[model samples]
Target: MKDIFAKDSSGEMVSPHEPGYDALIADIFATIKTATEMNTGYRTPEEVHEYMERILGKELDATTTVLPPLYIDYGKPVTIGRGCFIQQCCTFFGRGGITIGNDVFIGPKVNLITINHDPNPENRSATYGRPILIEDKVWIGINSTILPGVRIGYGAIVGAGSVVTKDVPAMTVVAGNPARVVRKITTPGQQ
Candidate 1:
């Protein structure tokens, strides 16, 4: 089981026993501290962006806007692109990784979870993950949950409250639990 999903050098899973676990824990706690500071009070847009940049360890574009009460585990594996807008109360479990491209709009209360717990009860505490990729110009509807390992392609529209478990094709609309393709989009000036 470990060989199939090991993320560390030891060919072992990430748990209390693995290398870098202590530092990972420390980073999580630090993120918690920053989240407490950033989420507590009413902050201006610029302030919000500032704090988010600090948390993400990367500068966000000036045009990009993010509301407060945003949550994350470790910021090391998260990369958000330019001109993105992340709504309030979005939680990112970025232990694996999350890549958000330019001009993406993530709706309120959206959860981008990258942690996939070992299904075996004996090893449930151990986690393996895959990156969640949101391509440019994509719109994720309110309350949607983007599961680990799915790529939302460019110009795709994820319907509200959908649970996306697979890659969405570009210019397509997806909805429902284990989201299915509902429609295909046609761009102007093209057939």
Candidate 2:
């Protein structure tokens, strides 16, 4: 059976005219409800966790600290691991699914976009899903934009204000509009 909503499992294009469109719209509204409540006020860490769980429909790992004013599109396709520190004003378009590994640090105003619309004018209403993966111990800097289908490797660091379009190699530093590799760091005690 085909899932109407854009998820990582399928590369099929999703349009508002699909058969299961009503279910998709329901999820969108539900996510908006939870996101509004969670982002509006001075919610404590515990409260934030609770709201996040409701939004995602799953248990958020312990020790994951998320500041208020976060935005997400379709939270069910997203998975956040333990011990992640997500700063304020981050936007996640998880329609294509997002897998964030443990101990990751995402700086403020970061945007993780997982869906892209078809370029053809007549099919512009249709969108395709491509998952985004962030491995453990990675740090994404402030105002960075990670595009669809990007896999950030472990222990990597993304410099502030970057636009990542491709897979980032492990243990390296990347920055710039297109985000090129700047340097590779040696593990402590190795050199």
Candidate 3:
């Protein structure tokens, strides 16, 4: 059966477990290690941006600017929609799939992680992953981490330094480690 999420040459449905899966996984793992070990080393913003462009192997959009020293380890596929802004020193560890919708604003030092290692010493060496989804118009504050299997719904606001381990309901504001709902957003225009 074909997988709806899998992309073909024409961007149509394809098998998710196609022949290229293993190679893709290997490549991602190798790149992940390199990304984890990289040192920003006090470079200026312009230099850092240039470095990231080379490391990521894609040109960053003019509108979607990443400040200096952005560290992302995407072990799996990650899709970032248009007009998104990701700040400096952010880490996106996408072992599982990570999907960020349009008009999303991510503050500095934010971490979007999508995998968890096993506690058992033997299994710990093996790899595991989960999916992370962030819908449109969401604002994730500085130093916040969205963990594995998390879905931050549309128009939600995550406060600074929060750790998200669960689903964030739509139009809500959440804060704290293991982030909880603080309030609901009543108006779109309101901050």
Candidate 4:
């Protein structure tokens, strides 16, 4: 059996040997397949949490809740803050590091990708990654992607289906690929 948490040559983690390796791998593949087959419908938050608890080896913090069918590669380190809510089907490929701050609400189908392979096929085997940081009280809309080396500032709001490629300033609202600031999240009530 393959290790479910093996470290790659670059010191990044890949699947390694574990008793639960087969089960976890099978479950992850099944979830992805099931998500693709779903005809549009909303899943309850509680259901999502239960699913995550089943698929992931570790228990999430009580204040850090994830909506069902979240796909996270558990080989790397990921930290969620208190009162954080992660929506359904979010993919956190945490080969580097992913940090979600307190009171952050991540919308459904969000992707936080921390590592990337080289474009040149010859060098592609070498893996490189950067950390993704989301500050306190940030709300990421549905289907958004936070790319490597990104830092979403405190109180920032990322719009639906946006791709964040750079650092977002504090209290701003950004949208679109390589997200741009459109507004500032000013008041506590506004955010």
TM-score of every prediction relative to native: 0.91, 0.95, 0.71, 0.70
As a TM-score, model 4 comes out at: 0.70
How do the residues 58-77 of candidate 4 rate in per-residue lDDT, one tens digit apiece?
Answer: 45567677655656664225
| Candidate 3 per-residue C-alpha lDDT over 126-178 given as tens digits, one digit per residue, 9 for 90 to 100 | 34567789999999999999998899999999999999999999999999988
lDDT top scorer:
2
- In candidate 4, how many Å is residue 26 off? 13
Candidate 1 wrongly placed segments (more than 4 Å): 1-12
State each model's CA lDDT, in order: 0.85, 0.91, 0.72, 0.72
Clashes by residue pair, model 2: none
* Candidate 4, residue 90: how far the Cα is off, in Å: 0.8
Residue range 56-163, candidate 1, lDDT tens digits: 888878898888899888776788988988998999988778999999999998999888777889888887777899999999999999998889999999999999
Residue 112's lDDT within candidate 2 is 98
C-alpha lDDT of residue 108 in model 2: 99
Model 2 TM-score is: 0.95
The stretch of ten residues in a row with the least summed lDDT in candidate 2 is 2-11
TM-score preference between candidates 1 and 3, better one: 1
User: Model 2, range 31-80, lDDT digits (tens) per residue?
Assistant: 98899899997998899999999888899987899898999878988999
Who is ahead in TM-score, 1 or 4? 1
Q: What value does the lDDT take at residue 171 in candidate 1?
A: 97
